[model samples]
Target: MKETLADDLNLLSAFCGVRDLTDLSQNALYQKYQLKKADAFVLFGGSILSGIDVLITAMNNQVATNYLIVGGQGHTTNALRLKINQFYPQIPTKNASEAQMFNAILQLKTGKTADYLEEKSTNSGNNITNLLQLLETHELKKDGLILCQDATMQRRMAATCSKFAPNTTIINYASYKVKVMEKDNQLHFDRKLLGMWEMDQYITLLLGEISRLQNTPSGYGPAGKNFIAPVFIPQDVLAAFYRVAKLFPNKVRTANPAYAKSLEN
Candidate 1:
């Protein structure tokens, strides 16, 4: 039997939880470029330390013609640059995050491919905006833009990039592995919950859902009209309950015993 639009949407909604919707449309554009061997790469960083490792690994791969590192303010960029030099002493380096154009001259001087840096951005949105401006200034296009960031932030970064630079291609190189260490273990006296790490998993799932939703064309539609249709009312209601419960734990405990128990246990 042929499935209705609502049916199909319901199925999709079940498979993927709450999402940003824009991810769906952006993914199509990402596939069109197929930037396996591009001329340049634009890498965004969540934090200087965590972001640098991915950048170094990308540089070592020699996949793209050059690299563009988007960094935060203060000593973060400097620290990252130092780390890169220490690790890959052979690879020539320079500090040009503030430079107007692609640090083409410095890149040539190093005898390696070109590398540019945008030091002004604090988050993913600014990173894409600055990268677009840099690309325009250098007469570059979407075919060569690869996005690199921490695995946790890749989805949001990609969504921002898609909105700002629709034509520009972005390839994500961040690994999606979350490592738990013994030091992270903690005890909860009141509820017996282990640690705050569970919160991170939920955030990750939410971000992933947002990323997936943002890729769809309908995901970019008006928020008031068809932003989120309830496919699974129970799950949706439960999510809402959890959100409120988080804010008013005591009130939720007095109000709904079942919900409080579910959330607590």
Candidate 2:
């Protein structure tokens, strides 16, 4: 017998190990980490709107003094900046969509506020590449960065940053937990779909960055572009979806039957 969408969702919920949303608040984490006044918070991820929301909330709540919103080079980042400017005009902003712009933003945010070298980068690797440029431009010996992004992508970003900027302090602000659902039985499990989605965005970015990097003479070449792929699969993705569904079982169970069926199909 074929399992229903509800079944799949329920299974996913079980795999994810549901945690009470009330207990999952960021307050304790913020307090524990003592993220009172950061030089500038950098929110980088594919979930442009949610990332911006979290960054604005954190700033309003005094979690960070200023913020630099960075993301893959595409419409999302463009739309995000437009929305932010439309909503908050008092805040000074710049479009560091290019590598040079990113370097300028980094220096200004870090209190240097001086002219520096700008390099164009298009993906996570490029973000790191830009950071290296920022470090070189400002002659920074050591620095701390407040990383704000989706919880799913934080680990990979941390690992990448550690490889490139080993001396820099990384303080992560996990924004949200992503859950992936299965089609057959709604089983919830730990998976990489969410991460993969983010990784795909990063991959698209790397493609652009690879083109840019290749144009440079005697550069590292395009090999760095492959670093965006993670070592996980669909199982973890399904589990995460289930876990989130379980948190609101009634909502998952009753949510439009047609939509649920469509998911299975």
Candidate 3:
């Protein structure tokens, strides 16, 4: 199957629709603010290496006083390890959990580490549950929370958090926003960021998320597995999804075998 320039644009539009990236600083450059720092920041480990740098920058801006890094060895573990090995050869990547890898970079770059870490979670569903359990165990309470996750999983993470912590203020600031561009009839990203997904894999991840986001039995919404809250998809997003799906009918991402074993619990 061949994809045209227009097809790629639709793919990109649909991809952006499901993603939410709030600006933590709102374009502040050494500006002062009166808002109190968030009660806590929650970082979800992922394959996107740029997230580490983004979170660090946010920390430098004094976004939060404390944070917890959450992730375990899941489908993205190998990719993260590979990125670390490729970029920072000295870092140990041997069987490193996502939180370990993220914490390693966070420490090396910023001379700091997360206040806590939830390393036993393998998927988004457990990521929230395990995070809550860890907080409760420590008796950590926060009226407001900040969520930093990979752009691909941003919405789902926030939705899951909202479901469990209905009253707490949930602020989303994704680590990266993957914007698709066009040049000479070609579809490409503006620049290559660290740990960037291959174009095909990025599209697969985006489309796969839509399937999970759809309000149906096969989705992660209340009608389905109840993994997250009900999501409303706009008409443009729906149209783009249909267009992109037509171009790549069989390209959606499948769950790793680990999901069945690890998430079942």
Candidate 4:
């Protein structure tokens, strides 16, 4: 039997949790958890300048009195740094944490500073762990929270945060441009329309995150006991994930070795 577009969309929707993404407007956030009631907001770093833009907007809107930027250099630091330099040539990017670079841009754009910077986190998991530790160190309690991350990362971020900080009410806000679409019988993006990252790179990250959402020993969620995320994967979504992997074998295989191995078992 041949697969239809509905099948593909159902799988994609299940994997991406499209409902969550669409519900991330300012109004939705306010409806769920009024920002004014929150002690502070957090920016989980990775996408460099784009992530900073969201942070700055949150700051400008008075989302909260305090804001935290968390991240250390990962795979995309250099590319992000280069983009930062293009806008603010004088601002130093080298040897700076994602928080520091984002702060510099924030200063340039809004003439304000982030309240805290946790520069030790190296990936999504640590982004939560380090920030939680920082909150403890500062004696700050997150009553209500606004977590700003790449749109593609909202699901994982929410899962991890829920597992670790169940008391806090988290309102997720992310960009709408970072999306996955199918065209010409293949997965792709229009670079001219949304030029945040290369199509191949973006797809890789998307698939990698999908792999991490799996409830398996090799996954990063609860099943793996990594304590990073607590995501539930519907069987149909898992099937779609495998189908997509088969469609883009090279990219999916390279993006997540464990996902490939899981299929073998």
Highest lDDT, which number?
3
Least accurate stretch of 10 residues (summed lDDT) in model 2?
256-265
For candidate 4, the per-residue lDDT at 25 reads: 40
Q: By the lDDT metric, which is better: model 3 or model 4?
A: 3
Q: Give the candidate order by descending TM-score.
A: 3, 4, 1, 2
Residue 239 of model 3: what lDDT?
A: 67
User: What local lDDT does model 3 show for residue 222?
Assistant: 89
Point to the candidate with the largest TM-score: 3
Quote the lDDT for 74 in model 4: 61
Residue 232, model 1: lDDT of 26
Model 3, TM vs. native: 0.87
Task: Please identify which of the two predictions, 1 or 4, would achieve the higher TM-score against the true structure.
Answer: 4
Candidate 2 whole-model C-alpha lDDT, 0 to 1: 0.42
lDDT ranking of the models: 3, 4, 1, 2
Per-prediction backbone clash count: 14, 27, 0, 0
What are the TM-scores, per candidate, against the unseen true structure?
0.47, 0.44, 0.87, 0.79
On TM-score, the stronger of 1 and 2 is 1
Per-residue lDDT tens digits of candidate 4, residues 1-265?
Answer: 8765435544553455322324434555566555444567787667535667667666666666578887776656676777777766888987998888888877887888889998876666667777888888999977777777665566777777887788877666654343346667775543333226565665556666778777688677667846555677777767766776676666652332221222111
In order, the Cα lDDT scores of the candidates are 0.43, 0.42, 0.74, 0.65
Model 1 C-alpha lDDT per residue in residues 40-89, reported as the tens digit of each score: 75655443233443444456665566677665432224544554465445
Count of clashes in candidate 3: 0
Provide the lDDT at 216 for model 4: 80
